[model samples]
Target: MGAVATPLLAEERVVTLNRIVAVVNDQVLTQNELKNELFAVRQQLRQQGIRPPSEEVLRKQVLERLITTQIQLQQAALLGIVVDEETLNNTIKNIAAQNNLTLAEFRDVLQRDGFKFPLFREDIRKEIIIRRLRQRQVESRISVTAQEIDDFIATQKAQGNINSDYHLGHILVSLPDEATPAQIKAAKNRALAILQELKSGADFKQTAIARSDGRQALQGGDLGWRKSGELPTLFADVVMNMKVGDVSEPIRSASGFHIVTLFDFRDSERHIIRQVQARHILIKEEADDEVKPEAQLKEIRDHLLSGGDFATLAKRFSDDIGSAQNGGDLGWVSHGVMVKPFEEVIFNLRDGEISAPFETQFGWHIAQVLAHRDFDNTEEHNNTRARDLIFQRKSEEEYLSWLRKIRDEAYVEYRLDD
Candidate 1:
């Protein structure tokens, strides 16, 4: 009430209108970032011909996705996860090549499309870092046992699902964010009802158009020809069990309930490779020796062909200590196990015939094929395929669960309402 001078600070302060939409740990997501992401999302949806949910739904979904990305980036930074300049540049260049544009043209195109070049680089760098993080933290934890591989191979062979491709149809009954148990139950019931309709001779495509909440719903839910490791783990085992035109039971996921149909199937044949059993005498070059490695190997080959015992020469002169003691026996060499130069020469050799000395990175070698066979590697082939499939399936499952665990543990705050 004293008419003294009023505080002068109020007149000098300027307020900024830029809003923070979300808080991810110590990082704040501003309105500009949210708008940019929403714009990108809308463009993507339009390109995909997807009928996205309401604007509010789209905004919430996009915001949540951004939050997850932000949290991951923050975690990556804490762990010192980084993508080197060379790798990032190469990755970008490869992407440009894939899009049929040179790197300079790609930069121009991105700018023309309203994306800043620096921002795009950062996005790609983040992606590579996240992939590396997943490989280190998630994939490394997964293990495939010898017995597991054998069993998996046996099962796949029995089911004839190995080396098969599937054309699939999908239907999703999506639940709301933070869906309550009651809502989940309702979603499941809806999924079951749709499944029943599908089984009762309702046209699957027509039903999908009318009912599915999937992004591909308008396209009759058709997921065209996918091979092993190309599909999400949710569909791997289920699809294998399904006959063409058969619909699956509802499968639960973070988003919703999914129902899949096997629209078509086909078998892809495996390849057979020839193998050789061979022996070699390798002589490494000595810098101080008057005789060169090549000349030494040639002399050894001459002695062998002139009736010197192969085993005695190998033991006396061969540098391959492990095989030298065993008379230079390489056991059985497969198509790809040995170096190309060595393999090419050895593979062409007639049984019990010595070859002229040849050079490989490992030094000089003279070889003889003791035996060769037109081996049927179908079982081994299937086992390799099965091992990969099982590892991929298990790793994908573990990756998702690990991602969810990390996401849940992070501290997030919403400021959008304010």
Candidate 2:
């Protein structure tokens, strides 16, 4: 028998131990890397209560997303770009403050979300790097002339138009993502049930507290007056036509079922701010990790309750920079001017009455409404409007330009056909 010649060609692809996940230049993406990012992604989605694909599917998606993101970031780094730690920390602090958590509490939240601190820090780092790269590389190149801003404003005003805004409140009931089809149906049914109850003389607030899964549940599902367009299309549609004290039927959304109540409909209400010449002392709620701000707020609350000068105390103790500078004066603010909770209280207050200390996205505030006024357009107002228009136009141009450059320069490939 003749000796058989050996075939050098392998019939199949062999996986290499050296290939952890996939390497882009020197950056090696590992399973652990994908896991960390995916953990963060799932945490964010979970907070929104959004339903996504299975963990396996999400892992694949996160891996792809990170890889694409890394490409953009790498290109940015090549331009000798970076973000300052102070700015990044402040950004995180602002986000935490929006959720009413102090820095420590916010850290706890990220920890509980199954993310390592380094993972979160790196997430922020990359975001800042991309942002700085975009600003330095792209945004700095884009500009809108002052004349353009003026022209846009004039054109808008020539339409005899005030920017359209709606003042309405809502009651929302959300369902978990892991919910079954029956559960979704049940959620909708419960929303309908709430509507029926409201129509049958049940208190809207009471129903909301008992049934809503959203954060609005705490305030009885009172969304407390947002612009008409700010709401989801479905919710916005029903509320726009309805008069005050109206209740909506079950409104379906990806987040689950929603029901809205229109407490008041004020068009151009935002432009004509109902100003309350009020002073306030704040009392931040005391959590163990956040006692100082809280204790300070409580002391202020006690003093106000005991008859200290609201304005005087506010100037000294209130942390509201704009208002504190003016003796805790929030100059005439439109419907959406203040945070939702504070706005509700301000609008509800009759002039000269002090409110009970109320907590908002900010630390707690105890506001006093000295007076209320309708809006007037003065030269100052027009100038202020013009400046705002300029900022908005410039910011948008910069933001869009930044996004386009990153997205266009990104090199992405999909291994899975889907």
Candidate 3:
């Protein structure tokens, strides 16, 4: 028995291997996934009739995109952010509506385009989750203080750019990285020539397409509507000095030379703000209710006229549950927040005047205006716009930095190179 055991041999194991392009943290990205994504993206570009980059460029870009998406999705899962079925369905419906198609037709189109509807739905769900995760982590973290907004507004006012909206046209003569003096001069001369043509009543868009090297050259450099502090630094000050339909001289930046045309300008925030402190007792109609809602509202109104407490009556009878618990108090509401009919009545009402029972989309309503104030909200609007612009600017910067930080910190292994 011992001699027979000495002759025993070990069994050999065989393995099958598939190519992995990347290893991100604990997850691996397979070559098949990369190839499939690249194919889909190329198909999309072809459908749009846009020229795609070379195979090498496209592969690198697509792989980078996939890796970034994978990192964000992992973060989303760790943070418990999920796109539920109902929300995903609603988003799909909205997408269909935006493309002027019904749900059935949208599915049909997807099938015709060589996409599986289920996979598309999953992709949309993942995209939404990633978006929500980014907003939670990056965009929501940006804060613009009241003092910052005030300072921005004051600076714009000093620059004579307060509350201004400009319809802008731009032509950029771009320079490559690390350009020599001669190249810079040539770019500047090109910009100057374009400026001369623009000032001579030549079509700004046509000139932009034919000669401008701007990113929006394809769209004829139309930079639709922009508010003060929203323009690029090179043109911001120059544009403030220009009237509608005026073109500027060549302006130089690190990336390029610019020539801007002010197609239109307007004082967008010059409006009187009439705000009201009001309360309402809403009675939304119920389908099963036998009594007429209008008659019930009238009874409630009569009770109020007889010195019944508004808060108590609202708590007991008001159907607008949101304000009812707070004694039907709608606090100070500014213009454009309420329905048109509601606003019309509220603005016309004198302080302490209860409106007659009136029908709005939300059934019949009786309201009382506690106070009214009229003031110019132009500065306020400007401050809000400045805050928004600053927030947007900061968010973009922070988002890029955060993305880079995550990417750099991730434990990525390049298996494809091997």
Q: Candidate 2 on 289-342: residue-level lDDT in tens?
A: 445665566677677778877778888877777778677877665675667888
Error of 2 at 286 (Å): 42
Candidate 1 local lDDT, residue 56: 68
In candidate 3, stretches whose alpha carbon ends up further than 4 angstroms from where it belongs are 1-19, 43-49, 160-293, 298-336, 339-378, 415-418
Q: For each candidate, how many residue pairs have backbone atoms clashing (under 3 Å)?
A: 0, 2, 0
Q: Please rank every candidate by TM-score, starting with the best.
A: 1, 3, 2
Q: Per-residue alpha-carbon lDDT of model 1 for 96-116, expressed as tens digits?
A: 999999999999998987788
lDDT of 1 at 124: 92
List where candidate 2 sits over 4 angstroms from the true fold. Answer: 1-26, 54-61, 90-94, 154-162, 165-268, 272-418
Residue-level error in angstroms, candidate 1, position 367: 4.4
If scored against the real structure, what TM-score would every candidate get?
0.68, 0.43, 0.56
Q: Residue 335 error for model 3, in Å? A: 6.7
Task: Give candidate 1's whole-model lDDT.
Answer: 0.81
Write the residue-wise lDDT of candidate 3 on 352-382 in tens digits: 8888989899888989999988767776676
Cα lDDT for residue 13, model 3? 15
Q: Clashing residue pairs in candidate 3, if any?
A: none
Error of 2 at 14 (Å): 18
